[model samples]
Target: MEIKDKVIEIIAEQAVLEPSDVTMDSTLDELGIDSLGLVESIFAIEEAFDISVPFNANAPQESDFDISSVASIVAGIEKLVAEQKA
Candidate 1:
């Protein structure tokens, strides 16, 4: 699957919603995901992409990885995956 599609799928699963319900503009908070759910989603994404996310759940606002929106998260993951391949 493509990165954007996979990301939406994983995030939708975390939010207990259908993939079609998730959008690139949707934020985790907007999806009703709590901190724990956010962490779980990160883990799932990491495992799926085989790339570590530079996120600090305890200090989310200070983290290097962007989690402001699904599109930003997808971009970050795409960057990480590209770097890993390099």
Candidate 2:
């Protein structure tokens, strides 16, 4: 499966929604994803991509972050993958 599809699958599974309900522009908050769900989704993404997302204590909260959108999540994963390859 493509990275985008994998991301959608992970988000769908984590958010307890159908893949069809998730669009690249869909926001996680709109999907009813709470704090814990965000963490789980992050972990799932890490495992799925085999890349560790660096955690920053001063980083914005998931609520404050804009990773709710599928496009944003894909960009984040792509960034991580690029960093790993560097």
Candidate 3:
């Protein structure tokens, strides 16, 4: 599956929703994902892609990775994945 697809799937799982319910423009808050869910989602993404995310779970606002939207999260993960292969 594509990175975006996989990301949406993972996020959907955390939100207890279907992948189709997730949109690139949707923020985690809109999907009812709280701080704990966000942390879990980040961990799941890191594991799924085998990449270390430079995210500060306790301080998301200070993190390098962007979690503003599903699209942004996917983009950040894609960049990390590419860096790992380089």
Q: Indicate which candidate wins on TM-score.
A: 3
Candidate 3 residue 64 C-alpha distance from true site, Å:
0.5
TM-score of 2: 0.82
Residue 38's lDDT within candidate 3 is 92
Residue 29 accuracy (lDDT) in model 3? 95
Per-model TM-score, in order, reads 0.95, 0.82, 0.96
Off by over 4 Å in 1: none
Q: Write the per-residue lDDT of candidate 1 for residues 14-73, one digit (tens) a residue.
A: 999999999899998899999999999999999999998888878888888889899999
Ranked by TM-score from best down, the candidates are: 3, 1, 2
lDDT tens string, model 2, 22-71?
99998888888876787788888889889987643245354333474779
CA deviation > 4 Å runs, candidate 2: 56-58, 61-68
Q: Distance (Å) between predicted and true CA of 34, model 3?
A: 0.5
lDDT of 3 at 80: 93
Q: What C-alpha lDDT do the candidate models reach, one value each? A: 0.92, 0.79, 0.94
- Candidate 3 wrongly placed segments (more than 4 Å): none
lDDT of 3 by residue, 1-86 (tens): 99999999999999999999999999999999999999999899989999999888778889989999999999999999999968
Clashes of 3: 0
What TM-score does candidate 1 get on C-alpha atoms?
0.95
Mark the 10 consecutive residues where model 3 has the least summed lDDT. Answer: 53-62
